[model samples]
Target chain A: MATLAAVIASTHHPFYYKASTAPPEERPPFADEWVAKITAFRETLTRARADVLVMVGSDHFHQLWLDNMPQFLVGKAPFYDANWYNEEREFGLPRMLLRGHEELSSHILRGGLDEGFDLAFSNELRIDHSITCPIITLRPEADLPIVPIYTNIFAPPLPRPARFVELGHAIRRLIDTWPSDLRVAVIGTGHLSLELGGPRQFGPHGPDPEFDRKAVEWIASGDIERALAEVTLDSLWTPGNATHGFMDFMLMMGVAGEGAKADYADSLDLFHTMEAYFTWYPNGVPA
Target chain B: MSKYLLNKFLFTVDRDPDLVERYRSAPHETVAWWESTIANEILNCHGGEASTWLTFDDVEREALAGHDYVKLFELGAHPFLTLTLFIAMFERDYEEPLAFQKEYAARLSHFSLPYPDIAT
Candidate 1:
């Protein structure tokens, strides 16, 4: 029974690979700062000795398609490598640590339903950047095995806010039922606000400060359910195609529970269009 | 054709105070702004019954005549507002609309909207 550590979303842009390899000085301040933050965050995870991670992010069209998109899909591979960033860069994952984690997938599928999430399990699926970026960012050493979960937040007819919260509880239940004696961490990626594409794309890289302030206040106070409920497409995301990805942020709150607090948060510039943050669930709380 | 179209349109307007204010203060001008700024591609792809809910008044029709679908959908109050309109449009008969909705989603995912977290 592996323990669940983090439920994070992939906050990297789809063009991150092309962007990241550019010389640091030539990159935008936001991108450069993010790489540093990601590197530091990974070091913290290593220090915490987190043994297993349950990463939650949405896929673009890598594995599931519109014709057969499941609301929830869990990766069941014993050893899966990320296709876009890692493979293209010749970066190697810690394959030895990844060897024996199949049961975690079964446990999540079984437990998720008990908490009311209709999760689909896939063994042969390959992981894309959404799942891979956070892993590589937090654990460049790949010392721990990860259970990747993909949500259909980006497509039309996305799951409602309340349903996403339910999925979080389902993940908690899945972690509690795992047979392993390991500790876990969950990471949720995506924006506090601001959609990445279309006209909303024109200016405003940082999110609406008042909204971000309210969200932080809500999380610090431990009223997670309310925080989740307060988020809507218009208020929390950009108006166009940009709104789809923010659903992953709501799902992260579900996994983090009421007690988790934001360890770090910052809004960046490029139009002040981007935001990045992290939340951690301390060990004392029961899953 | 159904009264639901008007209900859905008004319901959308009522829910978004900003748009309601704009419509009340300057209806024709607001309509023009919507025509120019919205993404018609999204409207054509996901609009479904929303196209009918629109009143197509002479001025609005003239403004929107050559507009793209995505732009038309963007003119609505919010993404969710537009989304719900589509949902309501299909909610009655349900089945066929759902299949269309699914196909529409697949197409959207192809353009990089589906995966926000992956490093490109």
Candidate 2:
């Protein structure tokens, strides 16, 4: 049976790439260090010899927009193209014609549907900063086959964080059902607090470090129920509208299972953005 | 105008290019459409006057940037969507919409810097 080997979640802000190119004097002190940490995380993946990577993040109107936005989507594409570079020059990402795991994605899509998720499956999808930044930061080589799961937390009326937890369990069931001797890693990519536009359009109103610190403590406690009870959706959004990205973190908590410690946590404030990286492992799950 | 009216008008213009083109090419007809389509409905939602002639220049000057856009931001338009609308309009006149959008957003954005770095 396939085994869930690791679960990781982190911020995927475009500013990280911007910070990478900044002059040493102009750049934040921790920018380069955080990049190094992500690289180290990738080394851990390589050491674990993971067979497939399941990437979960939100779409930022790159491909899906107001006309047609689904709350939850799964990639069914056999081959996924990395096209952020074509649309925006700032990314500085090398284009990748990457492969997707059709079998694993199909199973997860079916399982999610059966588990009462109003899931939308797409064979035609575009990879944006949310999905692309992690690979660029952690796995620039883009060697691993990825299964992209999208949550429409970018806009309002997003799925309750509780639903994200349920989706994580559905993914676990999909892994157990697979008979192949595979090592699967689930990755959640997003940010801690972000407010794209509004009254604070140019003012720092997020990356509420206090909220983030408490939230991480909750995750590290390995108490999903407590986290769910305390870190309510309103509380997350109270920090900033962009904090809804925590839905991805909730998914990671669900998959890491009860007693999953946030063995590693790094919170960095880049410019005005609040970003963090975390690695959580299920109790008894191997490297 | 109410928050919903401004957001709904801008949302339609952002999502539909035909409306934008119409607003650009034929102001009176666009104003008519705005009156019948958006202004009438949204003003009814507010129980306010819905008779103003909304013109192309009014959209570009007031709705897009001038007073109404600022008011929309104040009235609680989704910040990300607000930036996206600016990017969409920037794409109309500029060569690099993303660059302009980012620069503009950065200027307006306030940062929460100088946090304690996480120990290795």
**Number of the top DockQ candidate:** 2
Per-residue lDDT of A12-101 in model 1, one digit per residue for the tens? 443344445668665654667666666665554655567777777777544564436688888888877565322242222222224325
- Give the range where candidate 1 chain A is weakest over 10 consecutive residues by summed lDDT: A89-98
In terms of TM-score, the best-performing candidate is 2
How many residue pairs collide in each prediction? Answer: 43, 11
lDDT digits (tens) for residues A1-287 of candidate 2: 88776777878877666567668886766777877776776665555567888999887656665535688999999888865532254345556676899988888888888889878988978777788787777677788899999997765657787888888878877787777788888888866666565333333434466777777676666578887887666676566657778778788788777666776666655545666777755434354
lDDT for B66 in candidate 2 is 45
Model 1, first chain, TM-score of: 0.79
Regions of candidate 1 where Cα sits further than 4 Å from its true position: A1-10, A14-20, A29-32, A84-100, A202-209, A219-221, A233-240, A263-272, A284-287, B1-120
Among all windows of 10 consecutive residues in model 2 chain A, the one with the lowest summed lDDT is A198-207
> How accurate locally is residue A260 in candidate 1, as Cα lDDT from 0 to 100?
66
